[model samples]
Target: MLTLTSPVETAFHRLPAGVKLGAVALGSVLALQVTSLAGVGLLLAGLAAAYLSQGVVFARAAGRQISGLWPVVAVILVWHGWTGAWAAGAVVSGRMIFAIGLATLATMTTRLEAMLMLAERALQPLARLGINPKAIALAMALVIRFTPVLLDKAAQLVQAWRARSPRRAGARIVLPVALAALDDAEQVAEALRARGGL
Candidate 1:
């Protein structure tokens, strides 16, 4: 998962999830206008301050989550560098960092159930068009809830492979991970049926 809500008693955790989510959407829109390191740096600086207000550990967790896309970021930077478009690469990477960073912040601060309730309320207008917003809300909540679990499982599999093999895990753990995911899905399906289906 990109973010898991911290149990820390931060002020942001007390705010309405809808407000934070709206702000994140607006922030993402503004992030797109950033075309220079200075603009991105300003945003990052502000975010850093906010995170730091929560605590050093909260800030560190956020940083780790942000770094997960380093491989993709590296490719963009290297490709642009090779083509002599270093500035463009920086802008793109910076935009990505800002956009994802804000979204992750909102995620980390808001409880998953609160987010689901807010999303369901926000989607109510779609009900007029015959859409089942509750179902959508449930799906979104499930994704938010399980994404971190899935990532952890993947990491554990990789670690297990590393412990048993001299070489890197790489693609070797894919099959096992797939099977684990399938098992999770089956369990979810069974539980949902027992609950009378969603």
Candidate 2:
């Protein structure tokens, strides 16, 4: 199968689930300590290397997502530079992006069942707080599973609208897309309930 999950994800999947989670969690924590341009640059370079090492496909996907957000990043950098806070801001932004990319890689590699298992195991200590960890994990898995479906449906609606009219899409198009996606979500929920998900 042509896979959305890249070789990086596949490799991460072989590690114990806890290890994958820890890598992301630890990386996130370390991001806070980066407060210089050098730090941010190094972090970005390392993340790029990691993604590239995974495979061309993963690197492409990561590049596209990062590129799409370049405008936002530029605005942040400019604002911080004006305030003489460029170093701190860049570090914060770079770490957040890099950590997210890594964590996403983990999710792409790990199956839903494995994610749930890890979630359940992690939440075990909190069970005494009246939290149903399994339920929470299952809910998260469902959300993850449906996110891309929702995005694709919305994209399709936008394409259809663009085809029929040359006018720029506005809130009118977005509102209907949201409603349609909700309806699809409802249908999915019904199916899941029938299968004892509820």
Candidate 3:
């Protein structure tokens, strides 16, 4: 699995994972409450400044991670445009972009182990209910880690499709991506079993 954490150290990397995660959660909530285009723009500007503070390399890496949002944004804009609600579309898109940016920043700065530890601690109380905190935390960590891997797989499929055909891959790659994901899951399950199964 490819880790989202950047190899280049930054000031944000020194912060506790819990704090960073909490901040992202709070920011997401606030972003959702924002309805005005101006408000969303201000928040996005602040987020951009935060990224800039981390240095060019770190900011560029974060931008690449969130680049996946473009398609979704385009869909949102198209739908809103058809409905004649351009302002609403812009606000919605901005809020989503800001929330994802905040999350990407946190993920890029924090280590997977630290996030797992934080999750485990947060879920400790659930242990009394016969729920394994370690297992739950590990599951959460794996989901975070594999999301980008799946996206990369989809990208690879698209590239392969383009290599042979002039047309876009579009939905044609869905089945292949699903099968690939299943294969990955099976391998991961086997690896977990070998390591004393979560």
Query: Candidates' lDDT values, in order?
Result: 0.85, 0.74, 0.91
TM-score of each: 0.85, 0.80, 0.85
- TM-score order of candidates, best first? 1, 3, 2
Ranking by lDDT: 3, 1, 2
Instruction: Please tell me which model should have the higher TM-score, number 1 or number 2.
Output: 1
Q: Candidate 1: worst 10 consecutive residues by lDDT?
A: 1-10
Off by over 4 Å in 3: 148-176
> Where does candidate 3 clash, by residue pair?
none
Better of 1 and 3 by lDDT: 3
lDDT of 3 by residue, 78-189 (tens): 9999999999999999999999999999988888888889889999999999999999988887787788899999999999999999998999999999999999999999
- Predicted candidate 1 versus true structure: per-residue lDDT over 52-144, tens digit per residue: 888998888888878898998999999999999999998898888878888888888888788888889989999999999998998787776
